[model samples]
Structures are given as structure tokens and as C-alpha cells.
Target: MRLRVQGLPTAAGVTRVLSLLAVVAAVGLLPWLSGRDPALTVLRARSAEQEPTKEALDAVRSDLGLDAGPLDLLGSWAADLLHGDLGTSWVSGTDVLPSVVSGLQVSLALMGAAFALALLLAAALVAPVLVRGRRSAGAFAAMLAAVPEFLLATVALLVCGVWLGWLPTSGWQGPAYMVLPALALGVPAGGLLGRLVADALPAVLDERWVELWRGAGVSRARISAAALKRVLPQLVPQFGMAAVGLTGGAVAVETVFAVPGIGRTALGAAKSQDLPLLQGAVLALLLLGLVMGAVAAFTRRRLLGPALRDASLALPAARPVRTHPAIPLTLLTVLAVAIGWGLLRDPYTVNTAARLAAPSFSHPLGTDGLGRDVIARLGHGAAPTVGTAAAVCALSLLVALILGFLPGVAAGAADIANALPPVIVGILVAAAAGPGTGGAALAVALISWPPLAAHAAALVQEVRASAFLTAQRAIGASPSWILTRHVLPSVAAPVARHALLRLPGIALALASLGFLGLGAQPPAPEWGLLLDESRAYVERAPWAALAPAVALALLAGLAVSGAAYAQGRRVPRTGGAGSTGSTGKKKEALVEV
Candidate 1:
């Protein structure tokens, strides 16, 4: 009789155990390593003051669990962790876990609100542009991504805090204080999402199913919806990754805004070398990232299964492409109008008047602590924050395109360049240029290189394998001619997509740097500087911090969402009539591409 044994080894149990062990090691060892040198040095310094009696030394050692062996230390830590004892904060003399939990609640609320707002704004902004086939929208989105969140926050703080004197510069108040920070965060995210949708749409257009739907007399709108559904599953993982990065980046952002969130708490802990608090915060963030990742993976698995099962089915016939001429012009007009209206508003006058008078019919958005009109400040602030981001995006994209193109043309050299660290380039450029706009530009340019290189390499590989490219080469066309006529055109969509995808993250990072005093200097209305100034007043008037913090968070959220939306809408159509595969064969499509 055949034994009813399992066919393969059940590695799931082993994997789970190993994963848990890894987590434990990471959480425990990292803090120990970071604190060890400083702790030992402190101990040595203290030893010179007076040699403690052996009994007293032993008592202190036992209290800190320092006398225990490695295994005992690990066991004690694990036990404490399991028992909800996160240890005491060296600085605050309070239980670390409780403080972290309280701080996290505020952070979660801010993050959740900001993220939701961003997603909504992104969808709204991107849908119309994508439906109308505006290529410039993608570029605009990329520009938004290029501006850093720290820079945006700083600008907001300066314009709103200093010039208008409307909002409090630092501290948490309530939901209202979150609006500006959230918007500041969301705008860039929205811009990037818009670009992503634009890029993804072109790919969807080339899919056999889309063509089939069109041939079957389905409306373009319906086909678009179906394509979005298919592409969305793939986007989940990317969104999760972005979210994870945002969590880490949020620390600087919250600190800059002086918001009483986990990020601010984490910063405080880091400064004081509060090992337990720091570790706890890091672990919580890690767990959050893991959960998001798992959800994304599950969604991808489910969506990919059906796509794979329908590999060989013949697609319906293609329909004629529809192009819109007025959409781009109309969008440009709207942007111009919005900017003009903003320029006409005077924030300082509004703030002064509002402070002298109470809330009335004229000031609908209400006055801040200094009696500044919120509407006027937002209007004035929009110019610099949005304009700087636009400039950064354009400059970075240009740099990316140039660098990206190099890899496609010279693979070996490109690979070498790609391997070079961005920090080295940033340092070199910063040294050459002083820490001003010039340095910011250089840093952005350096950071942009890797993404561009990767995209260029992929495009080159794709071009090398394309039938059209091969045919052109076979006919003895000059390399320049082939590249100009065939290769560039084919790779345009992917290149555009990559540029857009990088925008929001780049912008947020740059903004964070600016907030941390590494970017723009004083006298300029930067969000980070405002937060720094407001820290002293945080306990008394939390609204001072809350306002700018919320603004920053919102702007980042919007930028990311917009990019994702844009990517979702774009469908790749080059190389073949409707083939999804790079080899021009019918097969199950995975969401990876």
C-alpha cells in the first residue's frame, strides 16, 4: 500500500520560525549595538569619579540586567516584550510602551487622514487628464514628485507662519490643524499618482483584452475601467512600499512641524539615546510595514491567478484611437488662472486685518492664533511651494532622462555609474556648491541617476528584443536612425513612467532634508524652520505645530496617490498589435510589469 505522506517538505513552519527569530534579532541587536559604545564610554567616565562599592555595583548591574549572560539577556528581553513591559525611558523616567502607544495614536490619525485625502485628490486630478490623453500631465506629475516634502513644509511654514502670521507654527491642536500639513504632503503624492496613471494607460491600450473590448462595441470608458481593475492589483505592492518609506520619512517631517506624533516621539527618543523607546518605535514601524506588504502580496496573488489562466485566448480586434486636442490647452488655462488668482491675494494684509477683527463674513476660512486669514495664507503659500516643486521635478526629470539614456546606449558604463552611491555624488556636489538652491539641485540630480539608469537599461533590453527594432537593424539602417526612429519612440512610455514614479518620493525626501536644516536656510519661509521655532510653545499651544505637520503629510499623500492613479491608466501599446509578452507570445500576464 502506498504511504499517505506529503509530497513536499512543509517549509512554512520552518519559515515562520526563522522569520520570528530574524525579527527578534533585528529588534534586540540593533539597539544594543547602537548603545554599546556610548554606554561603555559613559560607564568608564563615571568610574573615575568614584569607585562604587562591589555591592552597589552589583545592585545596579542586576537592576539593569547587565550582569546576565547573553542568553539570559535575550530571555529577559523576550519575556519583558511578551509581558507588555517595554522598559523605562532613561530620559523621561516613564514606561516606554505606554508613551509610544499614546504618541502612535496621534500619528496614525494624522497619517490615515492625510493618506485618504491624498488618494481622493489624486483620483480626481488624474482621471480627467488620463481620459483625455494628456502626455504633459505625466510630466507635470513628475515635476511635483521632484520637490521634497521638507522643502514644501518649510515654504508653508514661512508663508503661513511668518508672512501671514495666521497659523500657529508648532504643536498639535485638533483635526483643523492637520489640514495644511496633510495638503503639503498630499500634493506631491497626487502629482506622482497622476503620472503613474498616465504611464499605465498606454500599456493597457496595447493589451489584447482592451482591443477585444473595443471591437465588441464596448465604450472606451468601460474598457478603461476594466484595464484599471487589472492594473490596480499590481499597484498594491508598490503602494505598500511607498507607505513603508513614508513611515520612515515621516519622522523628520513630524519633527519639522513639531507635531506630537510618534515621529516626533521617535526623534526625541533618538536624541536622548533612549534605547527601549527607540527600539519599540522601530519595531512598531516594522510591523506596520510587514502587514502592508502581506496585504499587497495577497492581493497580487489573487489577481495574478486569473490573468495567468486566460493566457491563450484570442483578443478582439482593435479599434481606431481617439485623440483629444483641447484637453491639454484647457488644463494649462486652468492652471494659469489658479496661479493668477493666488498671486493677487496678499497674506500679510489679511493676517493683520484678521487679528484686529473677529471672525466675520469676509474671512470664511477663519483666522489663526495671530488672526491671519487661512485662505490668504494658503493662496500666497501655494506659489513658492508648488512652483519650487515644479522646478525641481523638471530639473530632476531632465537629469534622469540624460543619465537614463546613457545606460541604454552604453550598458557597461551605465552599470558602473549605476553602482556608484548617490550619497557620494550628493556630497561632492554639495561641497562644490554651497548648501543653497545650487546644492539642492545637485543633490536632486545625483539622486535621480539610479532610477533613470534602471529604466534606461530595461528599455534597451526591450528594444534589443523587439521585432520592429530587429527588422530595422536587419535592413542595415544606421544605428542612429534606428535609435531615433524606432527605439526612442518605443521606450518613451516606460521612460516617462519611471520619471513620474520617482517624483513623489524624491520630493518628500528633499523636503525632509530642508526641514532638518540640511536644505534651505533661514529668512525663507520653510516648514521645517517654522516647526523648529515652534517647538518651545508645543506644550502650551499645540496648534502651532499641528498646522504645518498636517499640511506636509497631506501634500505627500496626494503626490503619491496621483502618481499611482496615472500609472494605472496608461496602457503600453508599442512593439506588437496586442501581445503582452516581450517575446511576442501569448501567455499569462503577471502584474510585475
Candidate 2:
């Protein structure tokens, strides 16, 4: 075993070392690369009141360690990081570690609560599909993922926070205060889990052992349990991925809810261009993601064990396949009807007088800045915003899928494409397209490509080695047929999971662009546009800014929950046939087929 391990050609050790180095470099450089100017700006802003005397300026600089030369600063920064000191915040003129640590607790609380809720919600929502064979579950998950998290958060804040007065507008006052924000975060994540579980189940169902179980007269519940158990081992890694992705949404949510979390702090710092704060926040986030990923990988290696080893060694033979029943489609129909009804009725109608006024009952969702009906505007806005996202995701996924498959089919090009940095692509595309719908779309497409490409490449590799794909190829199946029937179907589960996982981040990016005056134009009724408009009112009518900010956060949460639910639903399990089967037999069957 030792000889074989040593003789293996894989560069896992090198990869691990490189990954660590990359992380270190990234964390170290952020303060210098993206933070210096901001730190200086804040220092200068502080020093302005004291006159631009050299002593005052020097004092401020010295206080921030800016008095040191760049190399010395970098060295100092490295040394501090090595000792777990995040350095002092230039903006706050305080030690960075305590603030970061304090903020981290809040963020983690929000994230953890949201994640737990999302998982529970997803399990309940997807259970019907698993037990009852309903396809609507999948569509509902898709639609949920389609809705932007910012938008969802807005609706929740208005309906739940304002109208119903069930929750406070902002602030983490107590445990109750966390509920709305957590739910807002959890809904989209749960939805993603549902979609993933839904998609992954079909693959497990198609496995030959499942047929054997069925032949043994296993009840549907028993079959589902078995399938779920088998798939759970694989599903854990996805949970980590979801957590990583949700970090961004969590930030937005925490900000909207006035949670005083790291995310909120980061946003404040970013707006003022507080370099050290921004760098610290971003580095912390990156570190969180890396840690989650590493943990997931380690867990997977530990749990799967020999099965993984065997999978890497010998490919199994193909067997007849069976399609699981479609998810409950009727649920989607009902949801659509509800959404339509909600749109038609006076969603904002407060009282009898308001309902009966001249301009009353004018619009269900009310009116915006241009005297346009809010309901009508939302209806109109939905198509463009949501539709653009769908288009962007599709385009991005298509590009990624093509790139991913090319390596399997044409090796060299795939290598080159994979080697290219997505950020470079994004910059190039953004530059060429310029700001507008076209530019926004191009940016989203480019930014979304990397993850999709990675997933697709892995899926392609898996499909290439799968028994079904190989069997089809051996039987002289056309390349297209092999791709469509064998490869594509096999990859669908992961692709759907990937798409849902990416949606919130992509929407946030789009929102950021809009906030930067690059995506939606003025008076467009977009969340980003609202944020831009409300910026001047930050101190006075802070609610103006708060409203949109909260909305963005909620929308992000919904996207995360939706994605999490979908992903969870797709995960496979393992268990009994007809509620009675030997543990060894079940385990063997799960492993064998």
C-alpha cells in the first residue's frame, strides 16, 4: 500500500502546497494591492481637520503603520499574520483582530442559523418528491433560485417586517431578530439543496442495485432511505460548498438586517474605501471558504474510503437504467397562481380608505419614484432582470460545458482554457462591451464561467470514465448520442447543483455593477438603482438606503435557500429494501451497483 501510494503519479502534495501558497499570497497582497489607497484616504480625511501639517500627517501615517516603506510594511504584515494579528484598522484607529473576531461571531451566528434552517426547510420540501414522485418540486426549486436574493429579502422585509410587523426592521436585538434574516438567507439555500437532492436521486435510482432492491419488493420509502444513505456521503461536500457560496449572501443579509456582522462592516468599509478593513474582511472570507473546502475534502476522503479507492481503480459494467418519477409539477402551478394573485390584488393596500381612494387600488405593489405602479413595475422588471440572469447563466454554463468537454475530446485546448484566469476574461469582456445591458450580461457570463467550467470539467471526466458512457461508446453509439444520453444525463445532477449554487453570487455581482452605475440605469426600479439613489440620503433618510439594502440582502438569502434546497433534494441515500435487508447486503449492493 505504501509503495503504491508513493508510486502514484498524482501531484496531490504539490497541489496542496501550491494552494496554500496561493492563499497566503492572496491574503498578504490584498491590503497592499487593494487597501493602501483607501487606508491613506481615511488617514488624510482624519488629518484634514488638524491642518495638513507634516507632523499630524506623519502621526496619522505612523499610527496606521503607513510610515514604513512598502517592503517593510509587507514584511510587517506577513509577520503579524503569522502571529494571528490582523493589524490595526486605519479607519477605526483600533486593533483589527478584536473587531474582526467580534464581527466574525455575529456573521457566523447568522450564517449558522440560516444554514440550519435551510437544511431543514429543504428536507421537508423535498421529502414529498422523494416519497411521492412529484416533479413540481424541481420546478419550484428552479423558480426560487431564479428569483434574486435581494428581491426576496425586500419582499420579506416589507411583508414580514413592515406590514405584518412580525419582525424589526434592523438590528440583532435578540434571538428573535435573527429569525427573519436567517430565514431570508435560508430559503434560497434550502431551495438549492432541494434541487441538488432531486437531481442526484435519479442517478442513484438508475443504479442497478436500485433495480435489485425494487425487484426485492422494496417499498418506496425504504428505497428512498437506501438511496439517501448512499448519497449522503457524497452530499456532505456540497454542504461545504454551499456554505462558502452563502458567505457572500450572508454578508449582504447581515448588512440589511443591521446585524453588525462582518459582512455589514465590510460593506461600510468598502463604501468608504477603507483599505485595511476591506482587505481584512475579504481575506477572512477567502480563508473561510478555503477552510470549508478543505474540511469537505477531508470528510469525503474519510467517509467514502474504499469505495473511492475502487472507483479510481476499476470501472464497473453498465446496466439497464430506470428514471425516477418527475417532481410534483402541480406545486409549481399553484405557486404561479399564488404569485399571480398576489400581483393582482392590492399587496400594499393598508385600509378601507386606502383601498377606496381615487388612485387607490391602482397598483397592488404600489408606485415607485416615477409614479409607476409598483406591481406593474415589478411585473415588468421581473422579466428583464430574472430573464437576463437566466440567459447569462445559460450562456455561461454553455461556454463552460463546451470548454469542459473539449479537454476530454480535444485535450490541449481544454488545458489552455482552464489555465486562463476568469478575472482576466471578465476584465477583457467588460472592457470590450462597455457598460449597459450588454456589458452587464458579458460581465456576469464571464464571472460565472469559472465555477461552471470547473464543475463541467469534473463531470466530463466522470462521465468519460462511467460504465454507461463507455458502454454506449463501445456499442458504436454516435458521439452526440453518447453525450446526450450517457454523458449529459450523468452530469445534469452536478450541473443543476452548480447553477443554483452560483445564482446568488452572480446576482450580487450584477447588483454591485448596478450600484457602481454600470448595470441598471436610473429610474429602472432595480435594487442596485435604488441603492444608488439612496446613497445621498444615508445620514438623513437612512431608510431609503436601508430599504433597498435590506431588499438586496433578502434576495440573496432567498437565492441561497432555494439553491440549498435543490441541492439537498438531489443527494442520494442508502438503506432497506421493503424495510428489511441485511446491513452488509445493503452496503454491498450499494457499493457494487
Best by lDDT: 2
Candidate 2: deviation at residue 18, Å? 4.6
* lDDT tens digits by residue: candidate 2, 1-593: 34446565344344445645644554455444452354446656566565556666566667667667666777787888789887766666687778777888888888889889878977876787687656566555645544444455655666687668887868987998988888878887787777666645655677799899889998988899877766666666566666765676665566556788876666566555565665576566656666776777677667667667345321221121222223223333433443454345432223433321222354433333333443433434344455667778778777777766754332323222223222222222332343455666675675466556656666566557655555666778898877676666555545655675566556666675555455666556555655655444333333444544544455454554443344334323322211111322222122200
Per-candidate TM-score against the hidden true structure = 0.54, 0.63
In model 2, the Cα lDDT at residue 68 comes to 74
| Candidate 1 off by > 4 Å | 1-24, 35-59, 69-71, 206-217, 302-593
Candidate 1 has its poorest 10 consecutive residues by lDDT at 584-593
Question: Global CA lDDT of candidate 1, please?
Answer: 0.53
Each prediction's Cα lDDT score?
0.53, 0.57
The worst-scoring run of ten residues by lDDT in candidate 2 lies at 584-593
Error of 2 at 486 (Å): 19
TM-score of 1: 0.54
Candidate 2: RMSD over Cα atoms?
A: 10.3
**lDDT string, candidate 1, 1-593, tens digits:** 64535775333434444554754564565334443432332233346465566665665556667566556767777888899888876555579898889888877776676667657766765676447754555555655654454545656766677567777666788765776666566665665565556545655667687678778999977876777666666565556554554554456557657887776675565445565676676566556556666666677667667756434332322222222434434444544453354346555553444443333466533444455543444445444444555566667556555654555333333222222222222322332343444455455554455455555555555566667666777889899897766666555545555656555455444545445544455534344433444455444444444444554555554444444354345454434522223422111111111
Model 2 error, position 242 (Å): 1.7
